[model samples]
Target chain A: MIPKLNIVPFVSVDNMMKLVLSIGVERFLTELAEVVEEDFRRWESFDKTPRLAAHSPEGVIELMPTSDGTAYGFKYVNGHPKNSRTGRQTVAAFGVLADVGNGYPVLLTEMTILTALRTAATSAVAAKHLAPRGARTMAIIGNGAQAEFQALAFKSLLGIDKLRLYDIDASASQKCRRNLAGFGLDVTICGSVEEAVQGAEIVTTVTADKQYATILTDNLVGSGIHINAVGGDCPGKTELHADILRRADIFVEYPPQTRIEGEIQQLAPDHPVTELWQVITGQIPGRRDPRQITLFDSVGFATEDFSALRYVHSKVTGTAFFEELDMVADPDEPRDLFGMLLRAAA
Target chain B: MIPKLNIVPFVSVDNMMKLVLSIGVERFLTELAEVVEEDFRRWESFDKTPRLAAHSPEGVIELMPTSDGTAYGFKYVNGHPKNSRTGRQTVAAFGVLADVGNGYPVLLTEMTILTALRTAATSAVAAKHLAPRGARTMAIIGNGAQAEFQALAFKSLLGIDKLRLYDIDASASQKCRRNLAGFGLDVTICGSVEEAVQGAEIVTTVTADKQYATILTDNLVGSGIHINAVGGDCPGKTELHADILRRADIFVEYPPQTRIEGEIQQLAPDHPVTELWQVITGQIPGRRDPRQITLFDSVGFATEDFSALRYVHSKVTGTAFFEELDMVADPDEPRDLFGMLLRAAA
Candidate 1:
């Protein structure tokens, strides 16, 4: 007899870490960046919607869902800034990828680690399209949990060999510098944001505060720098001053979403910003001159989660990194659901 | 040392079935109805929104989410009419209940069985308030998977001792009749809808078709009858004649949702309807007079699922029916997510 189709592949946190290590972090970032870019190039074929978020006093819980013609995916993620004070991670996530034909989940994976990897990879993909040629150094303004991933992703994708890190808490920069040791990059712990971005070609801001605070003022930023802004992802959360946005040629993942959640939320709703997909698809130009500043204001869309899930599903197939979860109910007879439950008792 | 708070309790299909049987199916339905009613009584406290649906040519996939101050819950469900031809269920579901304080999932369970139970319980709860006093006989117009559960819910909740069943396919009626045997209720398989509704105080039409096919007409439904319409729950899909809807005193779960997906989708958008929760809370009268026609047009809602998850969470706290799933990633240092990945490799 054939086995029932009730089993769904599940990737636990340990399994996800193993998968990442087995594939090698740099190689994984490069490959994931390719997948994300590929999805972005064909962005018109997707069913897009802004994430559905439920906000509370502490944080927000969101459901990000999207579908291509054949597959559907969604992620359940939460951002609680106060969680770190209580020994918990500020962000936690999990996602599901399902077949559109059968409406059954094919893969369920923990996405906290994957989200970090994908966010960094997404930033790298945008930088590859918009950053200046032969850029050798990057300044990360907020050296928090995402800082290391951003540093490594830029190294793997763009060959950046130097890093400058700064944070409001100097211990965070020290921890980031210690984590990046032996990663084949010269790391500098700067006392202030202005010192961090002094000579760097790329500037990444990834702070974790839930409030609207300026981590980078306009006068501190120089010309010809590509800004990969990743931290300002919810309402009232931003990192850059409005002057920087006014002077830069801004690009975003999805304009409607970015207007609400990205750093661009500080600007007017009708602010003219190019879509990053347009730049990737050659529908719009990314960088016109070396002196022009380009900002990739990413708010993390559903399609990226979909792409990451598809990539993970491809790698984990027929591998030990995933286990079969009996999540879907498959009865012997289609209409005999009650009978199936009765038989289980006997 | 305190155990990490990363473990989420998961209830599998087998465990859910075992839970239902252990509690006794009738008692389970009765108690679940009570829980649902209790939530309905406090409907003002819930965060309400229409279900987020992604429609496809074949079917629809939906995410239904709601929160009640302290806890949040969401259900992922799909409905496909063509699935039955391939020996798959027409509907499959699963859900998660999480903490509002920390935004961490507490319980993950298969909701296909639970949806069946809750759907039935919701119908019975409506019937208890809307059906004529001492309603003894019920006519179930669709004898499918849900028919038996609806029969039992009515039996346990309202003491409905006699059931008149009818279906387009005689085999479905036979299946329902066979499954409902020895449940201490008189079940009769009728040849037609009119025959089934003969001398019945309550009429339930639950045929599953993806079109606007009317199973009940104006003249066929008489005075002083309570109609529980469950199958008309999607756009372009309804089971009642517009004439009958015009004549009945319509009660609905959520007007915003029911107006688009319930039997009243045939009526005007601004057509006045009574919310079921108002009746449950005693803020509005139910069954205003003996000769009045009352219709409980339930399309299901997120709060009912929230109540069900809350009910399941309450029952399975110390029981072996649930297993711990290492679904969340907890790093020793929340900022060292990469370090957590690195240590897992060794």
Candidate 2:
């Protein structure tokens, strides 16, 4: 008989999708945002470090690990911008949550979908704290895999019901428009970044490109808008012009990491930036005035992934959304690992 | 239908044991040693780094990652010495091997068994280079979970047919003696570490303790013996006395890592040590003199794990020792990841 300790609850892509749909994407985003906010409120309790990255010509792979004294979590993610040409995701990920007391993994799940959910939820949380008051319109400047999720998250979390979408590839915007159809939001497919950001209170730049291509130019971004900079997450991959970063009060998740991978990578190492946790914990003010531009230089952090895993672990109980994976070796006698192997032959 | 890209080959604990048994433990160790030696020979071609460790009051969890430009691999391992009291293995591990070209994981396997195999094989490989001419007897000071594999590896790889086993817990030594009863070797269960090391050419210290407990004192370690120090693998955890280390010419895998986590951790940071790869690659001499003591301070390296994964990947090609897991999400249109989740609801 297989030992219960050896069985890790594995959430596959299908099961994750089912779980999201069952809870409804809006509700999932709201709940995930709350979890992320709770973790942010207690940020000093986590063991934080810059992610370990292995870069290649095509892309990079990274392992992000963090523990909150009780549970340890890590996400294995790869980003290959060129993967889309071969019908593969530009980003794919999986993560594990383990018990810190015994150093045993309790949950193993596909994080590609969860990452999407958490990224959007994190954007919504930031917008709630920093966006201009009574903001109702968001300009999604890159209508790709993350566009609709960001749209729904903003709509659900902050009551933003209008979206202005634009992508260099027109079909991507059409796809986003089609996906968000009848979701109780007005989605306009724009042709240019200028048109997308026109009269918008929130501008999200989430384009998929390996190079430092400016999806939003300095002149295009106006005052008082909360800029969610998502695509500038790796070295040499910024989506906004440097001038825009210079003009905005940057709020980031983990300054050490954001300074390397976020839009602030273009700035000096000692450039002043506020940690988002400080804003969430009320240690610092988010927006000083309605005319002040607040940029959440969002380069997804490990704590958000930890919170996502925590949320999934809580929701997956008494549900069939996960399968048991026999990943660990369990012997009746701890020292009899060899004997267990020998006995299995019989 | 599930996409081909989504299916990652998974080798469970049971399958790993079966594969090891089918190949015969002796042959497996020999082959694994060869793979490790080959990787060591070409060490300059691979990326290397110190393992990232998260330490707690109980134990530690670490992530060891390395890449050979073409393929990337990492192992997730934990060492909790107190876990044995709860009928759990002191160490547990799992690993993933991914393609660098596309950043897709090709294999995910239970590394608890493979780690045991590779560690023993690595010891044998080191012994092959550093041990005295025609060394026939090995004194194993800790007859625990790793003892049998270490004994068999030495016996098979270096033609060491005699064994002397000792442990503070006599049942463990008795268990080792009983396990290797019919394996074509003379096994003696000794009462003390001094008795075990009597007349033996090689001494292996592999006890599982979280603290700096000396299992081998300097008085017992005579000249001309090759010591394989395996248990002192983390900070503040060592098996050999500082005097023993001072008396021996230490060789290590990745000096930066060994200086922090190996037996040499007791020595100064600038203490001279030889890289094992140099010896394997014929860049440096091994077993310099008959009277000189050589110690292989093995803290386990990522490249060795890479070689183990490579070896398993080669052998499991046409075998049913693995199951395909739906770990990666493959969308019909890669940019439509949110659409994939939305369509799943319908």
The candidate that achieves the highest TM-score relative to the unseen native structure: 2
DockQ of 1: 0.73
Query: Largest DockQ belongs to which candidate?
Result: 2
List, for all models, the DockQ compared with the true complex: 0.73, 0.83
Model 1 agreement with the true structure over B214-279: per-residue lDDT tens digits: 999998999999999999999888999999999999999999999999999999999889999999
User: lDDT per residue, candidate 2, B148-226, as tens digits?
Assistant: 9999999999999999999999999988888887789999889899999999999999999889998999999899999
TM-score of 1: 0.98
User: Each candidate's TM vs. the true structure?
Assistant: 0.98, 0.99
Which is the leading candidate under lDDT?
A: 2
Q: What TM-score does structure 2 among the candidates reach?
A: 0.99
Deviating ranges (above 4 Å) for candidate 1:
A1-3, B1-3
